[model samples]
Target chain A: MENMHLDQHISKQFNTDLEKLRTAVLEMGGLVEGQLADAVKAIETGSMRLAEKVQETEDEVNQYEVNIDAQCTEVLARRQPAASDLRLVLIVSKAIRDLERVGDESSKIARMAIELSDEETDPDGFVELRHMSSNVQKMLNAALDAFARFDVPAALKVMREDKHVDREYKSAIREMVTMMMEDPRSISRVLNVIWSLRALERIGDHARNIAEHVIYLVRGTDVRHISIKEIEKQLDQDQ
Target chain B: MENMHLDQHISKQFNTDLEKLRTAVLEMGGLVEGQLADAVKAIETGSMRLAEKVQETEDEVNQYEVNIDAQCTEVLARRQPAASDLRLVLIVSKAIRDLERVGDESSKIARMAIELSDEETDPDGFVELRHMSSNVQKMLNAALDAFARFDVPAALKVMREDKHVDREYKSAIREMVTMMMEDPRSISRVLNVIWSLRALERIGDHARNIAEHVIYLVRGTDVRHISIKEIEKQLDQDQ
Candidate 1:
């Protein structure tokens, strides 16, 4: 009965700590999603104020990362969770880093948006940019939702959607390069678009990484450095 | 005496495990440094053989990351270290990821080198690329050496040198853009150069990240998401 009582106490403490970590991560996820959305909207509408707002939120996001990191370290040191619980802590820590990076990437796009708002508008590629931005935002939202629910299928879908983001980025780059080659005077403006597009592409990568962490947590396997086809096969086998 | 013996045993085991982890990280670091060297040489000499060699070493680098991650997880689970020891483990894990990514970036440069080798070599940009590559390699070496010795000054120096890499990258991009604008016929080749330059820039960023991890390990302060100026001020106060 003494052993049973000790196990009960340990289990209760671990669950409470895990819950706290989850809440903190989700709160961070929500803030990052907001920053990403506002940054994209700023670019779409050329709103300097909105862009500045996104930049201002970066400090808050950074604070979340530090706090979440501390919480994870505390949970690890104090709780000593093992197996799936341990994996949860590890993946939560990893996901927080990716989320923080998404925030950073959004800040980059916001800075570019602010700079581009002052220049003459070029609507030629803005439509594609909006499309790509919305697509990436969707992936991030899905990945965060999957994390909140621990839904592996949702995470897999997020991973698969990243390829679409890549395709869009390539086509956009091709278009931007062609524009720059056609009009030398617009080189600097087009270069800003190129940099902003790269930021969006990197944000997509961070979202994919979050989704990968979710899969790793649930499947107890490392799917990184492997082909998506291989990952799909493994998922199928697990199913 | 019984309590003292238990404490000694735990301390010995933790020290042994940490030493093992450090050796694994250093081994991974050495392989990554080799890959970076070969990748740069391939670009400089336009040698497909050297590029392929870098590609071959990628698997070995990936294995090291996997092995080191397992070791860290085991140490956390079995020993449950706290305080600075815990921070060391966490920072070591983070550093290993950065080192692995540096390997990935080198592979990217290698693939670009192989593709560019088939085309007529442009010696004009090759000189700049060589300079940037060597500078980045030096930064990586310094960062790894700092990690090995836990030397804060060397890490700070590595962080400072990243600005030089950035200047080199920007100048290279400006030259490439000018070349593309002057001769639209060379757009494809110039695009390749742009991609290669971006990869090198990313490598410098990874080196900076490693230096930041070293700072976190030594000073127990998170230096990321802040300006180097702020970090310098904080370091001065600490001293």
Candidate 2:
């Protein structure tokens, strides 16, 4: 009877620890999302202050990555979870690395924001960029939701949206280069915007990586660089 | 007697698995190293055919990465290794991913080689480009050796090499843009070499990443994006 009581206590402790790990990771994800939003705002409104804020936030993301990695190690050592549970902790650990990378790219965008603010590109020229930003922002939120709910289909959709982000980025690059060629006065400003667009596109890629991990955890398959249309066919076959 | 027999079997089986993992990784490393060599050769000699070969080799590298990942997963499930054994498997898995990325970038170079072949720019004008290609190739080889022997000092040297690669890349970019501005006829070819330089620089970065991961596995520390001077200092401090 005493041994059974101790077993129950240990199980409860592990559950608490797992919850702590999940909360810690989700918190990190939230901060990255916030940085992305702030970076976009910085670019749109030409706010050096907001850009600085996004840069500062990356340090926190780095700390979170370190802390989460250490915690996952401890849990693996102590809990020795098998199959799904083990994959879950490992996935979270890897996903947080991607999240931290997202923070880094977002911070790069913030730097570009400051540079562009100094040069004064017209806000009108940033409409396509702003639209791309919103799309990536929405994708990030949906990805986080997919993680929170363990919703594989939603996560898959978020992954699919990354292609749109890439397409928008290519168009942005072409447009900005043309702008630079046509008016050398705006060259520096347009270049900074192009850098920011590249950063945002990368942030979207990392967010998509997180979504991929989420789906991997829930579905136990690798969805890396695979098309969503094919994935849909996969789901149908699975069911 | 039974316990002794079991211990012997476990040790023998563990030793064999470790040997297998090491051999597999080394083999994959060999293929990737060859691919990188071809990429540099293609660009340096301006051989579109060599570049095409590198691009074709990427499919083989991808197959190796997939094979190694599967083997690692199977080993993890079957052996459930701990301590150094666990670390070894995990490190190799991560290494394969890094190598595959290296292959991807080399393929990018291959594409650039084809583009440059069609470019009208005088191939004789790119002295700095030739030097940078050799530097990147040397770094890849050194980094591969660093991985093979877990040589921290060698890896530190490889990290220092990356700064030179970046500096050369920027110089090449400046030179190319100047050539383009001086003669619009130079745009297409100059841009192709610039893109190739960018890819080569990134390849150097990925090599540095592998070297850092080697340190991480050997020493359990993350030295990403940290200065080479500091990394060298840490290695000295450790010794």
Candidate 3:
């Protein structure tokens, strides 16, 4: 009976540690999502102040990445967790990396926002920027929510939504090209918008990465280097 | 006496496993570097067949990433390696991800090579592209060499070289913008070249990432999210 009690105590401690790691990862995800949203808003409003805020928030996101990585390392070393527990730690570590990259891309967008705000371009260009931003932000939010709930279907939905952002981005790029061709003087400003659109498209790619991580975690399979159709078929079998 | 013999055998097994993992990582690095060089050559020669070769090479690179990840996962779970061994696995896994990204960017450049072959742009632009490609490929080669030999100074050199690529990229972007402004009819072709330059810049970033991983692995430090001056200072202290 005493041995059983000790086993329970040890298992409970591990559970606590695992929960802490999960919570830290989710918190970092939330912080990245916030930075991304503010970056989009900064671009739309041409607010240097909001862009600065996004940059400041990135330092915190970086801290979370370091902290979570340390925690995962410690757990892996101490617990020697196997099977599902091992998988969880590995996935969390990998996901933390994806989150950190998302934060990096958000900072890139924020920097572009600051530069774009300094110059004036067609306000019509921003309508496309706004559209792409919202779609990507929604995809990122869904990815995070799916991560939180371990929802594979929601993650798959995010993957599908990334295509829409890609199409929007291509159109935005073509539009910018046409605008520059029409008005040569607008070259620099249009280039800034083009770079920002590129950043947004990359943000969509990062969200797709997070969704892939969620799928990897829940399904015990790696969906990377595979096509969307193959991923979908795999998901169907998993279900 | 038997226990001592058994201890030696277990240690030998671990050493073998660790060596295998390192060999795999180095092999992957070599393939990525080859693909990067081939991609640059494809652009310089404007050979569709060479560009297609780079694309096919990416499949092998992707398999390396998946295989290396599995080996790391298995080692972490089964060996439960501590301290330096654990760090080795972690760093190797992270570095493999960076290398895979480099391969992806190379594939992107190769695709651009195929597209740009059909269009004529300023011959001057090719000069800049060639300069950026050679510099980045050199950086990547140095990074992989450093990883193979665990050479921190070589890694530092690669990190410094990344800045040169960035400057070249910025200048290239300016050149492309000027070309677009001077001849609007060249807009589409210049845009393709611009996108290809962006990919080269990202390839530099990935090389920087690999360098940072080497620094981390050799020195037990996290040089990421920090300035180059700080990294230099830290290296001085470590030396």
| Candidate maximizing DockQ | 3
Ranking the candidates on TM-score from highest down gives: 3, 1, 2
lDDT of 2 by residue, B164-238 (tens): 898888778767666656665554466567667777887888788788877776776667656677766776777
**For every model in order, what is the iRMS?**
1.9, 3.1, 1.3
lDDT of 3 by residue, B39-70 (tens): 88888898888899999998899999999998
User: Which candidate, 1 or 3, would have the higher DockQ against the true structure?
Assistant: 3
TM-score per candidate, in order? 0.91, 0.87, 0.93
Best by TM-score: 3
Residue A178 alpha-carbon offset, candidate 2, angstroms = 2.4
A75-176, model 2: which lDDT tens digit per residue?
A: 765676666666677677777877888898899888888877766336435887898889998988888887776778888889889988999888877786
Judged by lDDT relative to the true structure, which candidate is superior, 2 or 3? Answer: 3
Where does candidate 3 clash, by residue pair? none
Q: What share of the true interface contacts does each candidate keep?
A: 0.46, 0.00, 0.74
Error of 3 at A122 (Å): 3.3
List candidate 1 segments past 4 Å from native.
Answer: A1-11, A236-239, B1-11, B232-239
2 or 3, greater by DockQ: 3
Distance from true location, Cα of A142 in model 1, Å: 0.7
